[model samples]
Target: MKDINLTKEEKADAIEAIKSYFFNEKDEEITDLSASLLLDFILKQIGPLIYNQALKDTHYFMTGQLEDLFSLEKHVQRK
Candidate 1:
């Protein structure tokens, strides 16, 4: 998977959320720059794993749907 790039707006939103979480959960404050750096670090470290898992989940779901569709077709043929 390509680097998980976010739009400018999304980056800003995520940074804000991280800043808020630190304040709310840890009673610590973070600057916008710090939040952004943290976000980038987290994404770089975990994004590939997350992306691969999502692909696997999607493949599994689609395969099940396909199996269900074939089963339905067989049932219809018997009617």
Candidate 2:
């Protein structure tokens, strides 16, 4: 899988969220750099798995919809 690139604003927001989680849940204070690094690691290692699962879910949903559509087809009676 290709690298996932986040926009500047998104990256900033994610970094802030990471910092917040560490502070709120772990009661630990971490710098922006630390949070950024952790975010990078997560995106690099875990992002592909999540992305693939989402694609599979979408494919399954579309396939079901197509089957439902096919069920509505009308058959012509032959003489």
Best by TM-score: 2
Residues forming the 10-long window of minimal summed lDDT in candidate 1: 70-79
Model 2 — TM-score against the truth? 0.95
Could you give candidate 1's per-residue lDDT for residues 1-79 as a string of tens digits?
Answer: 5788899999999999999999999999999999999999989997888888999999999999998887766434553
Off by over 4 Å in 2: none
Candidate 2 per-residue lDDT over residues 36-77, each given as its tens digit? 999999999999999999999999999999999989999989
Q: Give me the runs in candidate 1 sitting further than 4 Å from their true place.
A: 74-79
Model 2, residue 10: what's the lDDT? 100
Residue 44, candidate 2: alpha-carbon lDDT: 96
Using all chains and alpha carbons, the TM-scores for the candidates as numbered come to 0.86, 0.95
Distance (Å) between predicted and true CA of 37, model 1? 0.8
